[model samples]
Target: MINTILPKPFLFLLLILICAETRAVPVPPAAVAYTADIIIYGGTSAAVTAAVRAAKDGKQVIIVSPDRHLGGLSSGGLGFTDTGNKEVIGGLSREFYHRVYMHYQQQDAWMWQKKEEYGNKGQGTPAMDGKERTMWIFEPHVAEQIMEDFIKENKITVYRKEWLNRKNGVVMKKGRILSIRTMSGKIYTGKMFIDATYEGDLMAAARVSYHIGREASAVYGEEWNGIQTGVFQHGHHFKKEVDPYKIPGNPASGLLADISAEKPGINGSGDNKLQAYCFRMCLTNHPDNRIAFPKPDGYDPLNYELLARVFQSGWNELFDKFDDIPNRKTDTNNHGPFSTDYIGMNYDYPEASYAQRKKMIKAHEDYQKGLYYFMITDPRVPANLQNRLKTWGLSKDEFKDNGNWPHQLYIREARRMVSDYVMTENEVLGKKEVPKPIGMGSYSLDSHNTQRYVTDKGFVQNEGDIGVKAPVPYSIGYGAIVPKKSECKNLLVPVCLSSSHIAYGSARMEPVFMILGESAAAAAVLAIDDQVAVQDVSYEKLEQVLLKENQKLRFGK
Candidate 1:
């Protein structure tokens, strides 16, 4: 009772005492310890390339990967490579394809098909001197062997299954990174660091800014950056008035599926979403080397009813894009409507943590597997179409660990860093110029579907897929890989460089990543030698190193 009647000054004093006690507790020190000339975090093509280049340059390098495997999608069932202009590929990137050729030299390498039957047309790059180099298309295990060989040859230190610390453990002294700790309590201190991950995890943890979703086409003055509702290419669009709801177009009947009933965003404006992601499945029609597609658990027929309708609409060009690899296996990809892409379903994946990412991967696996099972086994499926699809199955020689399911899903694009320079469609189309070239990319600007929405004619149609060719190979700016000097001084991001969604489509290829990786490593080495921030490294010096390394900075005549 006496305390309740206390004066205002006394109460204020007690509050201050409590606040002081709370502030007196000290924060715990970061755990773990490691030291290297360069520490690269990721198992992507860029990560591997960076580690190899650094080691070859006589610098101590360590690759900390959360994956058990070495190569990213290159060894992860995406065997049919997405090579734009092969001439731009040099250094470690070219070395990878050469190894693939070496593997195919053995007669036993053609276990499933004869060597001559497979031919050499799509195997590797056509050399500028009119001779053929190693074929780019390869088996998953073959690519893995090549990566393992690179590691052995370089003797690079690798820490597999180690994830970077995204919390307070990325200790920085001044603007440079002092060290980075992982979730397993392992710390790595390096003079220079490359965040080669597709997600830009390490860069984000170091307080570097990044972007997660697609910006509006107008944001970067891009023509193909945002939602494209009416543009349908390759017959992937819905031809019928399929209801977005579970009750089949009756709004009063309530939502039918897991899709949000909210209004689909404006066609050209920005949205907090991304394009679909799926496994570039390595499949085979060979009987002995194929495992008949397994019916996934919790099989849902309703989930694939749209696909059946798509088939019945005479959109049966199912095998149009099964790009062939060696050994009679195919790096199958999205084709007609209701194909493999799980549209508008992977928005949360880029920024998700490890545990959450695994869950998302599993969910995608179930959905895709169930979709295949439904197509083959469901009574509603046309008998002719079912018979045709029955011949296809997962390749036995690939992804054996998870019942022939690929280990990695293709994350087409994610977490592009907002750096000093953002590459736009204008640059790719040759309508604009970018100085300070570090690397080059020439692929067609490609973006898969971002959403499946109803059209004005009341039919479901695929939207946001774009394929626009560039006038020529364009030089990528070095500033795109480095943040402004005020952001972070010592960090380099190769995989997720600064670019709009439309521009990233061309740059996101694996070969380009390898090119950027080498450039980033070269920049890191130069920075270390000059004892200057990465931003301060002269473009002239960087250009010399890139040229010496055989990296193509400009298109050859």
Candidate 2:
């Protein structure tokens, strides 16, 4: 019919146009309904552990992760374990360390260094414990491999690099999450959901109540809740007076970079400032496994002027926090007044959009990389410390895909859920008993500096570096992980559990995250079996199941 309506040349053009138009129109793929019994949202250690526990309980589980790798900080380079009291770390968390021990028991695991060369030194404990058969410290790749093994052994499905569509991604009906959609338009439906992310992205999208930044000391009756001006429990504070101005003692010349001009808020008063964050650098001195720190784009020497002044003041403890792990590597952390922590730079990270968060993360990475470059090459830095640092380089085998840099930026604190019962200093210091104990935390009330500001005496000092030892290991309540019955019924949050800022500092350790992840999975499964909201899961039955699964609910138990 078309041939009959036009000449030969016109008809040929018409056919070509039709073909081109057809090719231009893209046929969308059929939508897949990704359904699971339990959908855990995150790629942290908690996400892996939660998936494993749910799969072990005979429920189809899935991990919708934004990360390409598993094991958040545990595999991101925090190889030097921060276990406070290893006695209380049981269940899957302890099992993870035991697996690390088993791997190291093989002679092949010792690749860079010999077994005898790597001594058994750890955080106030033996790195390789023969009694419990647990290894506390390990390389990043080892931890990642163990986590991958967990997923493979349990046959848990993980959708990696799937970013949650925070805006209108969640479908909630009658206060219960029905499904969550990722940015790639993949829909995931589940009977129960677990928010195991460090950022608490899914929990926030689901409209669960949460707190960001420090609450006042009066909010939770916690002494360490708010802005700490004069308190310096750790050695990260400024020990000597450093000039705050660009020019020595000249206020009009403008304050140096990274030092805020605002008044360090009233002591014990609340403000919306987050603690500083840094990458837990994994460094090695071995010639075979070393990649010299590259100068990041936009490197500047003046950015680290404050540290140069700190050096001139005779404060030279640069190598203090380079805590060693196996294979002659170090889990380098922020130390001294001016170290790896990008203070006053991460205030907007908790609620930032994905695009904005990417910029913030890039800024932090650049700052740290530039700092490392400065320490090694800058003439202003003390010659002795500079030479000592020149020997260390990023571990070649660790985070290889990321150019030997740690893949995860250590998010020390983020969106903490505001559930029915908030864990506070009262519970941590044993001043109050936890209700329906689910797990235990023994680490001290630790928080990194939030701001670097000038003191009233017109000298520079760091603010909010706290470290208060707990009286003893204390129980973590079930209510800390579940949302209020009215807020959300089917979801559970473990990593960003309900806790005050100071209390979360202690509970934010990787082992505790794994412990809570397992417990949250148990509760989610029981809630599904009972057909009740997570808030209504009976603590009696939950406790019995936890104990049966070898979870330590108390220190002595």
Candidate 3:
């Protein structure tokens, strides 16, 4: 008989080891303190612009950022700027892209490839122009440097790596944020506050009302607010019929790893599901500045079986949208079915604790990195495709600290505040006019795939990816950014504003976020000056300041 019992001493040692493992915990960061007229949370481009605007108005503004770098997605590998109508981009947002144009004007900026060879392609225009004086697309490092310059020039004080203490950080007084404490034990007191974080951490801590996932169409009286299936406008769906089961056409064999066997809800019904998230990879073919995609710790080829099936079906649009940025680099985004979207991976991210969120982020990183490794090495992929993919590698220059990966995940949409004025599809589509115009949004109503499921006919399919173009550039209301007066009177949320799922899908562009950031700062300054709540700030007075600052509140058709 096999010996199964352990010695008494050995069992005691094992119990002790288990206790030590469970008892070990991360120590809280050392304490620090600050006082400012306005405190902005998050290190996004919006956070920087808001701080600058507040400082320009003579308020003592401070930025408490969780990230070490600035400009969130703009500086983070999403180098291909997504401004649908460049004509509507104005103020600091325009200034940012113009600076990108000037950065390329210098010959030394072209490190990996000659500027002439890189050529004129930026959101369908010359990236490096002297006369028209604007560049919509740029390299990641260039954008980060410019944002840092903005902070230095304005003398804005920023404390990096300081996360808001969600449990008991926000101190409320008379329906307003009196102060907030961070995980680092730093206390900040501000008259007016802005939650510029993508997750709306500060806003949630302040007890503000917010929505986490897609709302049913009936709630908003909109056509495109809920789960979308059998609609493949973006061409990311499967091109051919492929079985979702582990063994082709065999229910006994069960479902594939990526394909969910669960029934996707009624087409227009609601569910607690957020859109997919992926790292916008900055990849290059230059031999000197390329690092091969690494095989992560939990590399499972079985996880990517669906992709192998896709290749078997002869779908070859994988490289068609590896968008070129600068040098010989490309911003590798989700292009085809079973690609980088990582469908059904981020449903809990919006509300997950920091620790849980880290696990989700790591899972996404491993999946994406292993995917590239699989493409280059897996035998199931066609030889021609493997040959083409092997030429590209992660850009060594960008995201140098984090294994050449994008520092920020593309958090397309998250916790949106349900304030007094909720931006619905009608306002976004120009069918209903906003009562108070603070900024403009021009991108399409775009939401990435939320779930991958099996069709009744036994084929793999994706749901919740929609790309409906806006009728025209539409205004974003001021009330959308401000919390309901009854909930919290002094908090402003530019990144996670009051909007329906479909409406936020359009307004969540980086340029629009910067515009709203500036506008939110202007309102904060006004509120502080008048000693009133942010919701009580007059729109007429705020518009005067915005117009003076060259904000394009009204956009042309």
The number of the candidate with the highest TM-score is 2
When 1 and 3 are scored with lDDT, the better candidate is 3
**Candidate 1 Cα errors over 4 Å, as ranges:** 1-32, 119-130, 239-249, 254-260
Residue 245, candidate 2: Cα error in Å is: 0.7
Q: Model 3 Cα displacement at 203 (Å)? A: 0.7
Highest-scoring model, lDDT: 2
- Residue range with the least summed lDDT across 10 consecutive positions in model 3: 121-130
Q: TM-score of each candidate?
A: 0.91, 0.96, 0.94
Sort all candidates by lDDT, best to worst: 2, 3, 1
Quickly count the clashes in candidate 2: 0
Give lDDT per model, in order: 0.81, 0.93, 0.90
For model 3, the superposed segments whose C-alpha errors exceed 4 Å read 1-31, 124-129
In model 2, the worst 10-residue window by lDDT is: 1-10
Comparing candidate 1 with candidate 2, which one achieves the higher TM-score? Answer: 2
Q: Could you give candidate 2's per-residue lDDT for residues 427-458 as a string of tens digits? A: 99999988999999999999999999998888
Q: Evaluate model 1: give its lDDT.
A: 0.81
| Residue 119 lDDT in candidate 3 | 59
For residue 361, what is the lDDT in candidate 2? Answer: 91
